[model samples]
Each structure stands twice: as C-alpha cells, then as structure tokens.
Target: MHEKQKARDVMTPDPVVLPEDTPVVRAAKLMRDQAIGDVLVTRGDRLRGVVTDRDIVVRAVAETRDISVTPIGALCSTHVVTVDPDQDADDVVRLMREKAIRRVPVVEKGHPIGIVSLGDLAVEWDPTSALSDICAAPPNE
Candidate 1:
C-alpha cells in the first residue's frame, strides 16, 4: 500500500543534529528547543549515533548521573538502523516494527539525510481524515 510513497514524503529533511562531543545537557536543551524527541549524533558528515529524550531520563537522570560531565555519545544508540530515501514506506514501517523502534534515520550515499518517526507514518498512511476519526471516537466505543 505504501509502494508509491517515498521516504522523502514522510521524513523530516535537514534535521537538527548534535556532535558526539556535545554535553548531555546541551543535547537535551537542543531537543527541547527544537521540540524533537531525538537528536542524531554525527562526526562531520558521518552518522555516529542517536540520543533521545528517553535516553536522558532513563540512562542519566534515573541513574543519578551528572548531565554536565556526560557526553551525548555515552548515551547515544550507536550503529543505528537506517533507511534509504527511495525505499517504500511500507518496507520502512515493517522494518521499524521488527526493530521495535519509533524513529529511523534516512541516509543516502553514506550520509544522514533525514529522519522519520511513527507519527510521520501515522499521518502519511492516513492524514487528519483517519486520525480525527480515531481521536474523536471514545476509546471503549
């Protein structure tokens, strides 16, 4: 069903990212400022890892660690799974489901190009028409 849809159609292009050396607090601040859940960690143009708000809460704060001394690289999920910009959305969705991940980085020519989230797919698969129906109806109904 998603054969005709490209990653570009759903991916957030030119996403803001952080360097591996960025302090955890700074990364968190950037995520908050951008209103994004995840931040790609890069070394030059190469994708190194990814850090999410959950990572900070679960791996840092919950662990009682100091954010100032912690590098984002320390909490980042390295060797992240990625998708190609030209790949079909259905294939990407299947891959995400199998990996149990809500986000996937879009890469091209060995460089990070964009990112896609579960929300992106939800909207791509069905825009406000379907989403409104799901939201407007009572959960038990």
Candidate 2:
C-alpha cells in the first residue's frame, strides 16, 4: 500500500519559489527567514532550478564569489529532476537514490506545484522508519 503512494500524497504543496535571477544573498536570506534548506527557482510559471543553503556555502562562499552579485541560477541546478503528482513513490525514491538527490520537485504543465523530500518518502514508506525517528529526534547539545 505504501509503495503505491503517489508523489502528491506526501508532497509539500506551494513550496517557496524564487526567480532564477534573484541574488544569492537575497535567496539565502529568504531561506533563513523561512527556516528552509532549499528553494525552487522559476521563470514565470516554469520551473528552472533548485537551490539549497548548502549550494550557497559550497558553490558561492567557498569559491569566494560575491553573494550579492551572484544570481541563484549561477549555483542552482539546471537539469533538475521532477516527479509527476501521480507517479509511484517507489519510482520517485529510485530516481532520488540513483541521482543522489535529497528532494524532487513535483511539476505539472512545466510548473512546479509541490516538492517531495527524502523525509517525506521515508514517512510514507514506513511511519515508524528510522528516518522518521531521526526527524523527530531532538537536537543534541
């Protein structure tokens, strides 16, 4: 039953989105304010890329690029993988694993409508899974 779950069933609807041309610093600040790790970059209603807080650190800061001058597109992924709302969860998980990706955008008609993360798959696959437990576990001092 769990394996048959669809991407839309566990996806976070209306995820944070930004224009690809947004400055990296602005995007990072939005992420910080939202307390989210990633944002979907778009051009109008079309999905363009995905940018993570880690991307900013590893791709921009580490390279000594000026965050204020750098656009999110410069560091965000171009060939982002996506899943259909009706796609099988297993397939989504397989894609994520094969691509070493932690999340996948849920798109329809070239527009992103939602997003599914590994944690979402974990919880859907097994309610008492270790991944779920880890997500619930309190932070260590």
Against the hidden reference, what TM-scores do the models get?
0.85, 0.88
The residue pairs that clash in candidate 2, if any, are none
lDDT tens digits, residue span 48-89, model 2: 999999999999999999999899989998789999999987
Among the numbered candidates, top TM-score falls to 2
Candidate 2 structure lDDT:
0.88
Q: Which portions of model 1 show Cα errors greater than 4 Å?
A: 1-3, 129-141
Give RMSD (Å) of candidate 1 vs. truth: 4.7
Model 1 has an lDDT value of 0.84
lDDT tens readout by residue for model 1, 1-141: 444788878898987777888899998888777677899998877899889999999999999889998988889999699999999887888999999998999988868889988877776666666753553354441
Tell me how far candidate 2 lies from the true structure as C-alpha RMSD in angstroms. Answer: 2.1
